[model samples]
Target: MSPLFPDLALPVPPDRPALRFGDRSLTYADLAAAAGALAPRLRDAGRVAVWATPTLETAVGVVAALLAGVPAVPLNPKSGDSELGHIVRDSAPTLILTAPGTELPAALGDLARLDVEDVDAAPGRGAPYAVEDVPDTAPALVVYTSGTTGPPKGAVIPRRAVATTLDALADAWQWTGDDVLVHALPLFHVHGLILGILGPMRRGGSVRHLGRFATEGVARELNAGATMLFGVPTMYHRIAEALPTDPDLAKALAGARLLVSGSAALPVHDHERIAAATGRRVIERYGMTETLMNTSVRADGEPRAGTVGVPLPGVELRLVEDDGTPLTAYDGESVGEIQVRGPNLFTEYLNRPDATAAAFTADGWFRTGDMAVRDPDGYVRIVGRKATDLIKSGGYKIGAGEIENALLEHPAVKEAAVTGAPDPDLGERVVAWIVPADPGARPTPDELAAHVAARLAPHKRPRTVHYLGSLPRNDMGKIMKRALKTDD
Candidate 1:
């Protein structure tokens, strides 16, 4: 009902910075002026494309589109030609907004392009457009999901979803305008763009983008008054490895009000390492493209190492069996597919009626393909994806994440991914793809299996082990278990 960002409309000090990327920065006045100048150009457009780079221009472009009540489709700058072409053809945006001199790939050749900096150069152009009052149900963003199985589907996120999600996170994280957020995540994804950037804007806070994620960059910003840090597992892994040798990095992390990790599961090993060195526990949360944010470890609550805390405000979560029957008790052993209904849920998968229908139950809950278990206190621990992580072996269902965590505890196991492979007697066998901690002194398959059996139940132990130099991963540092070979 209210404006998504109330602070942007009200005049603040002309010198107070609202957003920063590397050395470049924009004050609230500068942002208001730039966005005001750009909104009019996009006023009549049905939909526009943003070359979502981790730059100030991309931020300004998206904000301007929102201000004008036009749906913005954020195109990932790193996507391949075919992927980019599919998105362009599917979305069919009227104009492409990009930074000055950005050399777009051949896929965007047919689209009209406008440099975002043009508005900044000619501030107060075309009589200062007033911000439109967009309805809560109006489509604000068309974010594409990672098309692992097929071409990416655009998730049509409404303005209310954004407003409600951020406000809920504000309550969960104790977020306020005084808190400065910092991250270097790619801007196209919901975690980076919606939460990392817009979350700060909604709270009337500032965000410092590092241009790229580096421990030095994070330390530098945090040391200079940044209050919170958001990162993926890879970034935190590096920080955990560096903290032993880097006091400045440790101190910087220790000084922060909160350290949050998302987009994938952060290993318990890395979590313990960071906490041991910095006396700060990294919080983990779970959500997907279709759901902006479902659950998070609260700032005011216990900083549990592995669980993703409780369901966020306005989110109703339930775990269901394979037959779609809801589980009642949360004794921590029963695992089920997570289905959620909330204001955070996306309206639909754009143009895919069948997919939109299939994604939700007849009753309105969005079926998240993620499988997880709940603690007695409602903390959700994601085991893995339903297709890959849930293994039925010898009549016992096992979650790959717990086994992977167990393998990671071994001194000789540097990295691990678990999956179910076809077996003759057992319906499926637990298989571990491991990277040895010491190349010359690699742990044997038997030793690794026993290590897991000791920590977890023997039924959940890896039936087979394969050693690899490293596990294949996506840009988000999530292990691509589907890509791993199971032939041997």
Candidate 2:
């Protein structure tokens, strides 16, 4: 088994920066030495709760966890006290690590606390404790759900599974030691843990954290020099909107070897607009918390506008109807639920055996809970979530993405979300919530209906549309259709 941390750190020049947070830069040697120094402190704790949002602390905590054999649970620092208390109770962490001002949840206030700013707090009692190295199959990290559907469920990820995901990303994206990854996503989600950090670190590449997002800061980083960039659709959209006409920003973004978008479905128009703004297509991939990313758009070939490309080398994908029978072929046009079986699939929901059992097929394929269809060319386009997002009306199915895509085509529309709202006559009615570009340039309901009718079938067009300042989105940029439905 390969040691999670390379013994000698990355082979980059000692003075060369491997991590950057605004003006701060840490060389490869510094990170390695810091990780080594922090290792014993973590080892003493046995279990650590890192309540820091995506930052250098996350990267350091993760690296320290691997080195010390302590299991790390990363929580959203901004989570409310009640939610934080629930997480603390569920995970039962031995020690809490946080920045000076982090509010402690009532339940965890009495636990031993380690101040993050004082990295040297752990004394140098240098005798290394013998630890049974965690096998690849042993649990490494526990990530909780976003609590969109209900209370967050902790999902335990095995070390092997994490490594498998990293390996798959490396193989598919051709990441190497020479690549530098600049990440602007939250570490609480799988996107940051596996895609943003592990994928690059496993390949011996240097990974940099943005701490907090500012388009100008990102532009400055790109201008300063970064080979790769990864972010969600929201981050990209913000950056695209803020610096629309800056040629220098455009050039810096276009110069990256690769730019990736995932964690949520990127609307087709948003995807295209970003590509036009920056000369490279933002490669969209498909993944969920249960399965770390398993598919991606090709680096060299034509990236289709509405589809995420084929499965990675070691991943197996199967589409099934509601009855759970696999579809015959990838015709790309037939929509069905996407089922995945891969080396990277998570072990189970922490302490929830029944839910875990129900999540998998009898034969072991994970029930992704996401519906998608494949084209004749084998490209995959995700329909909305099965239970909440997809709308059905008069025996016809409608996808949020499809209507959102159409609405985005209108110059006045900034963002849109479509959902099946309740109705007495139709089984369900298509409802749209939109953000308009011009305050007074809102489309009338008839105009909006006619706008979608021109491009879509009668059943597919939204019957009701509402103009809003913004659509409610989660941290990862996925529209909360359920919340919208609840609001009505």
Candidate 3:
């Protein structure tokens, strides 16, 4: 399959920057040539491991590997030596792609290494790659999940899945050549790599890539006139908080073609507040590492507050009860596990056939491990993570998201995380981890309990509320619910 970069690279405006990282900018011709030169090196090396932080280097590595027909694996740069060694031993990558001075194990000392600076060196005006005939089902990339529930498993995302996702997004979101995207999400995550990078780039739009999430830096990009913005919910919250005094920041953000929030659920109030402050409502979407992204709310329509709008053009979703019976979307607020059937879904876990088999239904749908409800209009409201987040008290099951959403409404609460705590009589009780809005004026546990009591059902209310200095998060800013659960 031909890479999406070749045709996009051609006829691009010569003077304009096609990729931006900090003060450095690469024109379309520069990036294409850079990718063209690195392709052969990657081919000679075989499977490549990319650990570059979210920067132009990561983007360059991805495009070059695809062009060279090399299956690329992207890792968190902060992964320790032991973890990195595990990946190295398991995948046995032909080359490691990362920053120049990053430390490597003795096993990889003699192995080939390609740094972003090396790739940025004079473009090797070598033979343009003879497009390798890779099958649509062949693995294109391997990305490990958050590894919260268990050991990290490599998810094999095929070329067809990537292409299908990009094609669907372009059609659903109406991505065009005229759009300019200011992207702040990490490149290693599916949301960042596929939706933030490939989705826009494949459609002929330019990307202003940030090395990391910097609210002020992103604000500058918006001020510089980016047409689109993509980030996680936490990033948006911080951005909103940073602009409390500068009203212009909100105005600049409102002018974007679209603003996307994903990777974690965003509160309805946060969505409304962001929209009211900035001119555009943030389009909340739903997806995971297994599937790139299959649902989204449109920029033009009413983005129903809590719902992640309908499934994309080529995707189909079904709700199934615990007993494997299909549930009607209109069964009076009945919620079930979301099983997805889509071209965008990943092939399987790299070497975990049993786990892969377990993740899918007896039919073809991939079990998302997430519970959601669909309104009559087909909008999906993700209740919570099925295994780690549901609170079981007495004989009833409660969604932690409901209590957290209610807790967030309090004036003294900045954020909230709810987990099930083991109880004597009930299987588990609701436990809330709260981040205060005011350091000194934070509410007491009794006060917070009263606050949630007012909004949630008697059984759904949190039995204990613990004030936390800060929530533990991954590189992508998603609260580590698995870690928080074990903390207590």
Candidate 4:
């Protein structure tokens, strides 16, 4: 019923910057004009493809698509030809929008193209375009999943989902026009495009994109004027490692109002290291592409490490057993699958009714494959994905995330991932894949196993330890356990 972004229509100072990428910046008026100019061209299109590059044009393309009431499908720039082909064939966008100098791969060459830079130039200088009133059920974005099991499925997100999620986050994070957000995340996913770009715009705030993630760049922006910093664990790990020697980096972090980490769990060791150095706790939130945002550690609440805080306003969350029964009485030890129902939920998977039907329960709760435990105080700590992270070993249902965190506590371990392997005696055995801190002085497998036993229960300790130079990770810094080779 109401517009997603009300502030864009209101009269704000034309000089107030709405977005900044490296040296280039766009004011609210400039962004409005740029998006307005391109919206008219896309008004009749049903769906469009956006070449999601880490640039100012990507933001403009998405905004223009939203203004035009068209669903935008973000194409990952690094995706392979096969994956790109699958997306193009699936979504069937009318045209592909990209920057002027971008060289598209052959997978996208056949589609009609429109350079956002051209429309961004002098198209809307004559008259301001009126903001259109889009129906709440209209699809705003068609974001694809990570495709862990099969080919990626397009999740059709509606305008109401985007608006409600942003509004809930604003209430939880105390976000406003005064807060300037800074990040270098890719615009293809929900964490980057919806939250990083649209979140600030909804609040009438500003965003400063780093173009690429670097500790020096993050420090420069925060020290200059940016009040918030959003990053994944890898970026924060480098920052934690660098803060010991770089006083400027520590000073920059100390001046930041909020430092949020998502996409994966931030190891408690890194969390403590950063907090000890800068006196700021890095807040972690949990969500997925199918669901915009389910939970976040409130800015005004306790900044607890290793736990994603309570559910946000208007979201109903519950932990359920495998039999579809809800688990009541959270004793901080029982792990269950997280099921959620809220306005932030996506409408459906594009062209796949079967998958969409299987994702939700008969009562309408969307079943998230993530497993988590709830504390007595209502904090939700994600254990891991149900497919890989939940290991039933020695008659105990143990979470790999807790074991991984314990392994990271050891001084000899630099990076770690935990999984389960088949065993004749035990149904499954806990196995730890580790990257040693030193190549020459690698800790013995027995010693590392004993270290985990000392920290956690004996049953939770790793039965076997495998050493590697590095762990395979996706772009989001999450360990790819499926790619790991665990040998007997």
| Cα lDDT for residue 257, candidate 3 | 76
Over the full model, what C-alpha lDDT does candidate 4 score relative to the true structure? 0.91
Q: Residue 30's C-alpha lDDT in candidate 4?
A: 83
Ranking by lDDT: 4, 1, 3, 2
Off by over 4 Å in 4: 118-127
Q: On residues 1-488, what C-alpha lDDT tens digit does candidate 2 reach at each position? A: 56665523435455645555545555556656655576678876766888756655556667677777777788886687777787777888888767567666665667777755533233232333333376877767888888776778888877777777777777767777788888777777788776777666667667778777767667766777678888888888876775477777788788888888888877778777778887677788888877877788877656777677888767899889779989987775566888999888888887789889999999999998888888776678988888876677887667777878888888888888888888788889998888888869887778778888898777778878877887887777777776675455
TM-score of 2: 0.92
Q: Comparing candidate 2 with candidate 3, which one achieves the higher lDDT?
A: 3
- Backbone clashes counted, model 2: 5
Write the residue-wise lDDT of candidate 1 on 25-49 in tens digits. 8877778889888888999998999
Q: Give lDDT per model, in order.
A: 0.91, 0.75, 0.78, 0.91
Mark the regions of model 3 whose C-alpha exceeds 4 Å error after superposition: 6-11, 99-110, 116-129, 485-488
Which candidate would rank higher by TM-score, 1 or 3?
A: 1
Clashes of 3: 1
* Predicted structure 2: lDDT: 0.75
Would you estimate the TM-scores of all the predictions?
A: 0.98, 0.92, 0.93, 0.98
Residues 326-348 of candidate 3: C-alpha lDDT, one tens digit per residue:
88755426768889998889999
Residue 53, candidate 2: Cα error in Å is 3.3
TM-score of 4: 0.98
lDDT, residue 108, candidate 2: 67
Query: Which pairs clash (backbone N, Cα, C closer than 3 Å) in model 2?
Result: 136-160, 331-375, 331-376, 332-374, 332-375
In candidate 1, stretches whose alpha carbon ends up further than 4 angstroms from where it belongs are 118-129
